[model samples]
Target: MAMEGESWPRVRAVLAEIFDRDAEDILPETLIMGDLGGESVDLLEIAVRLNADFGIPVDEDAAFLKSLRYLLAESREKGIEPEAALRAAYPHLSAERCATLAREAARPQAAPLLCAADIAAYAAAARK
Candidate 1:
């Protein structure tokens, strides 16, 4: 069964339940680690729930797992900061979204970059 529009709500609900919070409080942009009182253990639980609920493969070892800031810094270390690198790394995101992420990733004090939105996006992308 392919994930659909309902996936977002379901994803949010699953996170909410796993974290012992209300579903309404778990918005797409809510940071799982920083804002939701989630710990490292929560990451695995969330990934598991996402896979079981939406059939989305949440590879914790993916490049994006190190946070967008790490990705940007790592890319810069390689040479010639590429504009499409972000988009290429996260194929589920759009060009404009990639630009926004690149900017946010440059922030000095940015919080943990993984959010419910990422999980939702992964679910949507996995449907393809």
Candidate 2:
């Protein structure tokens, strides 16, 4: 399994290609839906590409993915803050990232609801 840093470029490349942008523009903090104009279909494509490129499933079946899905579901269900839910579910994520995820998740129009850091985190967690 490649380290998260090692997978960063590959993940960025995939996101760049999916969004028809330059890899340099896909910074770790770049938001998939908010900054990059990504849609649900783009997320599916990104997941497929990430799975192919990293040899790790980025689907609901993956533990990290499942956890995130559950977190989102629980957040929506229980009226808990998304950030709080993410903090509880993904302790592997940095405190900063949990804040970012919570902010994105709280947005009404955010689709994909991911940033480059999320991809790197998923890749790193999947490797473990």
Candidate 3:
């Protein structure tokens, strides 16, 4: 289920343009915000560009992991484990990654683990 082929290049190009970084430096594993110095505004631009470039609707919340805190809160309210909630919300991420994200979500100052591959996966799924 890994995102590959066409979507990576297109997503990388979009990230490069938005972050003003070379496309070659924008690896699939590169953290969008942590590594590229991306901000909330950049994420908005990324979502907009992905929709326009691929002709696919990009759910900005899902793509950018914007609802991590909300999902965690909801899970707690519903008596569900944070990891389970994270996995349910982001099935494209590995269970291990989801667990890590769940732990990180507890720390308000922690940057999300979202990466270029995550965005590319969203684009690939949207294409289908």
Best candidate per TM-score, number?
3
Best by lDDT: 3
Residues 37-101 of candidate 1 have per-residue lDDT tens digits of: 77788878877887787776787644134546656877788874644677767887657667777
**Local error of candidate 1 at residue 102 (angstroms):** 1.3
Tens-digit per-residue lDDT, 1-128, candidate 3? 24566988999999999998899898988998789988889999998999899999878888788898889999999999999998888876678778878897798687777889888877887888
> What are the Cα lDDT values of the candidates?
0.72, 0.70, 0.86
Better of 1 and 2 by lDDT: 1
Give the Cα error of residue 11 in candidate 1, in Å: 0.5
Stretches > 4 Å off in candidate 3: 1-3
Q: Rank the candidates by TM-score, best first.
A: 3, 1, 2
Name the regions of candidate 1 deviating beyond 4 angstroms: 1-4
lDDT per residue as tens, model 2, 45-123: 8788877888986653332233555677788899987777787776557777777766765577655555677777777
- Candidate 3 achieves a global lDDT of 0.86
* Candidate 1 overall lDDT versus native: 0.72
Which is better, 2 or 3, measured by TM-score? 3
Error of 2 at 60 (Å): 4.6
TM per model? 0.82, 0.70, 0.84
Q: Clashes in each model (backbone N, CA, C under 3 Å)?
A: 0, 0, 0
- Which 10-residue span in candidate 3 carries the lowest summed lDDT? 1-10
